[model samples]
Target chain A: MTTLSVRNLRTHFFTKEGVAKAVDGVDFDVAPGEILGLVGESGSGKTVTGFSILGLIDPPGRIVEGSSIRFNGEELTAARPERLRAIRGSEIAMIFQDPMMTLNPVLRVDTQMIETVQAHLKVSEADARDRARKALVQVGIPSPDERLRAYPHQFSGGMRQRVAIAIALLHKPKLIVADEPTTALDVTIQGQILFEVQRLCRESGTAMIWVTHDLAVVAGLADRIAVMYAGRIVETGRTADVIERPMHPYTKGLIGSVPSQNTRGHKLAQIPGMTPSLLRLPRGCAFKARCPIAIDQCNEMPALEEHRPGHWARCWRATG
Target chain B: MIVYIIRRLMQAALVMVVMSVLVFAGIYLIGDPVLMMISPDASELEREAVRKALHLDLPMWQQYLLFVNDALHGNFGKSFLAGQPAMGLIFERFPATLELAFASLVLSLAIGLPLGVYAGLRPHTAGSKTIMTGSILGFSLPNFWVGLMLIMVFAVLLPDLVPGWPRLPASGRGATVDVLGVKLSFLTGDGLLHLLLPAVTLSLYKGALIVRLARATAREVLPMDYVKFARAKGLSERRIVGVHVLKNIMIPIATVSGLEFGQTVAFAVVTETIFSWPGVGKLLIDSILLLDRPVVVAYLVIIVFFFVALNLVVDLLYSVLDPRVRLESRAT
Candidate 1:
């Protein structure tokens, strides 16, 4: 079953400079127990997409009127604040990139985790704390009882992320929007967290959308991958297909930018030029200005087209 | 934690010692207290007798030693005007000053926190802009002038239109029973009325300070990732701000309040003089005019001690507000 289906999602910011389309038209889905990696660079709006899924966007930046977010067949486009609050952290939860952000620094881990549980549940404080402890143990944190008494700063970065993951799993929500939960950790910690998270999804049948800029992490972890650029998905398919046969040039540039053992002592292939300011993106395909295979029709906005059964690309020049 | 407090107390003592020396020397540099204390037509013999009694005949260092020796025993000599121990006089008035300082603090926190939170929650809105502008005016105008203006409006002019509150005494420690024939004591209905204007005038600037500080800190905290995370947790706007944003901004608030409290206690001279309130600040100004060196020096020393104590309070407050600080202190 589809857990989340965001269609024509458009979030923009009205700043003094101009309207920056942070998350323009976008569409994607996550099925039960399947992990969809929303891979993009810093400004491609992957984080905004995650925030928009939870209705967490603030003022000056808004999810425009026409956007529709359907989760488990319930319309969330014009969902009231009360409805969204009821759904969030119970039916759907989000784990931020920074675990410190997930936990209040001044509060005890147990207090924070228990409160997170009680925010959506009517359980007693002791019962909530027990669930928090269990969740920590599930996330591979040992000495759950002692660790629960500590603050966020007491835990290392890796451990803190695990605590955050534990908080996300407190209710075993149907969907979790994890925005680069392991991006801040070292590689070994990253690998460990990735394995635990992937296993958690598999065992619990919880659908997840892991947003990250690290292609390597997504390549190894995600069942499916979506490559976003300039506030739109440029290419998406099975993780192996997207990695092996990148159809869009921006995807190719991203894959090439990765430092490989195969290219020892050689210069890395970098995507030339900076990302266009979201406020002043060109009046055409946003990536067309940098596309090596650009054509006259590339000046027009390209619809996301299904080039194969499950693979998709939004470039006019993409072909089998 | 005990060691930390002990260290702080020792540091406070050292600071007081250094400040006493400075204040003692500094007041003497201003003028001779004997000249101000004695009449111009006083006989030379009487002047000499007064000088000898005050130990002015001795050198400055010896006199400082004598002053310290006497001060250690809580004997700040005598207020030449009051003909009483200066330390005793200060103690008598400390409660009145404490009342004003604490009341102003309570008023500022009560008013400033909400005003600032509102200004921060909705920046650039019409109401927020008005508050910001009003706060700026509060900050710019001197308290003495504001006090006088308040007196003119409420005490001098408002009586013509209104009957009850119009008779509010503009400048006095205690109120008279003539207004509406209701007897009001220093600790009762009239007492609070007497406190209202002076406290408001005194608190206005610091209250404005608290407002701006709260607004700036709250504004900075609103965009924090943790705050955003709280919102995403399905917490209501009120809960997120009250639980997450308020606590995060509390360190700055505590620091500002502590400093402002110390300042109010030490520097309420202008407001007290304008309103003729019976506070230590009024006593200090009077002592300065009379060149009562002991009283002035003793007041300065007490203020220094207050600042040190306030510093300690602020540190403790920081630890309370942020567990991170407490953990660090424990580690040390």
Candidate 2:
């Protein structure tokens, strides 16, 4: 069953110059326990899409009216602040790229984790601390009771991210949005955290949307992948299928640019040209200017359509 | 923590020693008190007698030694004006300035913090805009001008403009009231009435200062990744700001307020003089003008001591408020 559904999401920023369509007409669905990797380059609106899901966009930037984000059949986009607060953190959690950013520098680990538990639940402090300890243990911390006494800076980068993951899992949230939670860690630590997170999601049956620009991380961990460009999803499908048979030219270019995919002593293939500024996106397909297989019909924007069963791409040339 | 305090105390003692010498030498070199104190018609014999009595005839180093030795023995010498002990006279007027400074500080914080938070939350709103504009006047308007402006509107004109409007006093510390059988000045209604003008004047510029500090700090804090993380955690707006942002902004606010508190007392000279308020500030100015060296030196030493105490308190508060500082300091 679908755990979260976002339809026609449009988040724009009203700037001094003009409106910047940061995330324009985005749509996706996540089933129970499913991990959907929302992959994109910088400024592709992937992070905006994540923030829009949580109704966390501040003004000057706003989720334009008519964007529908439904979680467990509740209309979250239009939910009252009280109701939104009820669902947030308790049912839906977000893991940030920097763990220190997630943890308040002035507070102890236990205080924050305990507060997260009590924010929605009517649990006593002891019960909250118990659950916090359990969450910490679940995230692979040793002696969480002692660790909880330490501050955020007391923990190493890897340990800090673990504590952050623990906080996200404190309530066994229905949907967890991780925005590159381990991008700053070394490769080995990143691998460890990714594995632990994947295991937790699998065991808990919690749906997740992992927002990242690193396709390599998503390739090993995600159940499905959605490729975004200029603020819209250009392609999406089962992870293995999309990796092996990328129908969208942009997806093909991304997969080709991976260093390991190239032979030794040979230059790695790179997508040509810079990512077009979202403020001045092309009239047609945003990638048309850089598209190797562009045709006259490409002058018209192509809607995201199913090229095969359960396989989608937003391109006129996406024929199986 | 004990070690830190001990170190601080030792440093403060050294600073006090250096400050005393500088103030003593600086004051003596600038002007001669005998010239101001003695009548112009006095004989050379009388002048020599006066100089000998005050030890002005002694060598500079001998004078310093005498000053330090007498100071250590709790004798700061007589006030050249009233012939009362300098310390005793200064202490008598101290509570008035302290009461004024504390009242204004409280008034500014109570008003500034909330207004600043509101401005930060809705930065583009008309109210915040007006506040921003008003605060500029707060920053740029001289304290004396504000005092005069407030007096013109509230003291001089308001009573005539509105019936039953009690005319606020233009100057003086007002009549004392009996509190618990003691004649307390600030506890009285008339005293508060007189305090209104000076307190409001002092609070206005400081309140503006706090507003700008809070507004800037709030703006910087709101965009931090932790704030986004907090929002995502589904914390209420109040909790996000109160629990997270306010504490962070407090670091800078506390530091600035500490400095300002010391400044309010130090610079209260002009405000006190304008109003004829019998505070240490007014006393300092009178002493300086009269070349009352002992009174002036004692007043400065008291101010320097207050400053060091305030700085230490602010540093300790930083550790309490920010765990990062605590850990870093401990590590060092």
Candidate 3:
């Protein structure tokens, strides 16, 4: 069953210069126990889309129109603050890139995690503490009980991120949104976190949205992948198909830019030119200026269409 | 932690010593003590007695030694004007000023913190804009003007406009009230009623400072990846502000609070003059006008001490607020 469906999401920021279409009309779904990777470069609106789904955008930046977010058939787009509060932490959890941001500097790890559990569930402090300890253990934290008493500052960067992950897993939410949760950690720790997250999701039947810019990380972990550019998804499909048989020119360029794909000592293939400003986006296809396969008709915006079974691309030439 | 405390105390001592030297030098630079005592019309015997009384006959180093020795033994000598022990005078006045300073600090925190959090959470909303504009006005207005305005509105205008409008006392301690068979005087017990106007006047400047600090700190903390993660975890906005934002914002708030506390003490001079409140500010002004050298020196020392002590407390709070700070210090 579909655990979360975000249809035609649009988010924008109002500034003195003009409106910045950060997330302009995007769609995706996460099924039970499935891992969906939303991949994009910086300012591609990937983060904004994640934030919009969570209703986390501050003023000046707002969810404009055409957003219908549903979880288990419950409409979230219009969920009241109280209802959303009830659903958050209990049914949906998110892990962030920086662990310090998750952990309060003045509060002990145990105090924070226990409070997080007690906020949603009515249980004794001891019981909440037990759950927090168990969560720390599950996330591969060493000396769980002792570590719980330690502050975020006592832990290393990697350990702090693990603690953050532990806090997110404490409630066993049905859906988790991890936005670059391990991007700031070392490779070994990142692998460990990814392993734990994947195992937990599969065992608990928890749907996850893993937003990242690292294709390799998604290649190993995500069941499906969506490639975003200039506030829209250019291509999406099963991870294997998207990586092996990329149809969109932007997707091809992204694949080409990977350093591991190049021969030893050879100059790495890089997508040239900066991402166009969302405030003054190109009149035609946002990627036309950088697309190697650009043609006369490429000047027109192309709809995201199915190129093959479960494989979608937003290029008229690709469809032909 | 102990080592850090010891280091800080040593630094504080160094500062105090430097301050004493500067204070003594400032008094000395004003004029020749011998010439002041031996005016043209003064008799030789009277001049000699005055010189002996001030220890002007001793060397500068010996005089400073005598001053420090007397200071250490809690004897600041007699005030040149009042002819009473300076230390005794300062102690008698300390409680009143301390009470006012604390009351004002509490008032500022209570009003400024919540307003700042709200403004930060919704930067461009009508409510936030209104608060921001009001705070800016509060910050720009002089404390004396605010004091006058408050007194006019509460003490003058309201009493005339309404029959039996409570008349605020011009000076002296507040009235005593009987509650639950207990005689409680605000001036002696709670101090809240007597503290109202002065606290408000003092808090206006501090409140403005705190609001700006809180807003800036909260805004910086709110966008951190963890805050978004907390929201994703389903924490309410209130929880986020109280637990997450407030805790993170404390370092900046502590700094602003400490500085403002010292500022309010200094500002109490004007506040005391306006309200005629008998606190250290009034004592300092009286001593200055009367040329009470010992009283002036003693008050300056006490003010310096309060400033130093406030900074020490703020420093200690840093470790409590961010444990990583302790860890980093230990590591170093």
Please report the candidate that would top TM-score against the real structure: 2
- Indicate the docking level reached by candidate 3: medium
Spell out the clash pairs found in candidate 3: A88-B234, A89-B233, A89-B234, A101-B226
Whole-model Cα lDDT of every candidate shown, in order: 0.86, 0.88, 0.82
Residue B64 lDDT in candidate 3: 77
The Cα RMSD across the true interface for model 2 is 1.1
* Worst window of 10 by summed lDDT in candidate 2 chain B: B323-332
Q: Which candidate, 1 or 3, has the higher DockQ?
A: 1
TM-score against truth, every candidate: 0.93, 0.95, 0.90
Task: Show how many residue pairs clash in every candidate, following the order shown.
Answer: 0, 0, 4
Alpha carbon deviation, residue B68, candidate 1 (Å)? 2.3
Q: What's model 3's lDDT at B261?
A: 85
TM-score of B chain for each model?
0.91, 0.94, 0.88
Better of 1 and 2 by DockQ: 2
As a TM-score, model 2 comes out at 0.95
lDDT of 1 by residue, B24-118 (tens): 78777888878888899999999999889878888888989998898888787887667888878887777778778888899998998899989
Question: Best to worst by lDDT, what's the order?
Answer: 2, 1, 3
lDDT by residue for model 2 over B89-194, one digit each (tens)? 8888887898788788888999888888889878999999999999998879998898888788888788889888988897988987755543445688888888
Clashing pairs in 1: none
List residue ranges in candidate 3 displaced over 4 A: A14-16, A265-267, B29-44, B53-56, B175-193, B327-332
Best by lDDT: 2
